[model samples]
Target: MQILDTYLTKAIANNDTRIPWGSLKYLIGEVMYGGQAIDNFDRRVLRTYMNEYMGDFIFDTFQPFYFHHSPDVSYYIPTTQVDAQQQGLPMKEMCLGISR
Candidate 1:
């Protein structure tokens, strides 16, 4: 979280905080699936940090496919300094399985 937050801080300072959503998606997948990247916990942890701290600005920018799943792009647009409670939006998540 520190590493990502550091990058985020720098990005925000530079007025270029928008990050490809696929990167995050892959990160989550890697965490859950392992191998593709550094596996950590499930997507929930990431979602808590990103979606909570910074507003999830979703877009159509698709990242290069390789990690084993597809996800929409989300710009880290922090509208408030506090972690806003997830309201209104239904709680839904996409789960993928390892390919044979």
Candidate 2:
């Protein structure tokens, strides 16, 4: 959880919505869960946690992230958890409000 918190901070600071394959693999496969040697099952569980829970609380722009993996790589991108209408404010409104 702490590792994910740290990475979340970095991701927010970097405004990075697209996390690469290597980073996710390292975080979940090696660094997390007592650093135990993990297999496919562990990976799926971690991925699900990120998708279902972590996604709800991460950065506003990048909220609802999930692992998108292929045969060779894994990545995280924004999920379709909430529709655009449900978001806080539109980009235009936010920009206009910022001028105040």
Best by the TM-score measure:
2
lDDT tens readout by residue for model 1, 3-34: 45665577788997567455555444444433
Alpha-carbon runs more than 4 Å astray in model 2: 38-100
Q: Tell me each candidate's TM-score.
A: 0.29, 0.34
Q: In model 1, where do residues sit more than 4 Å from their true spots? A: 22-100
Candidate 2, 1-100: lDDT as tens digits: 7887788799889988775445655576557753453677866765655454343344556443333345754344434644552463334423222232
* Residue 65 in model 2: lDDT: 39
Measured by TM-score, how close is model 1 to the native structure?
Answer: 0.29
Clashes of each: 0, 0
Pull out the clashing pairs in model 2. none
> For each candidate, what is the lDDT?
0.43, 0.53
RMSD of 2: 14.9
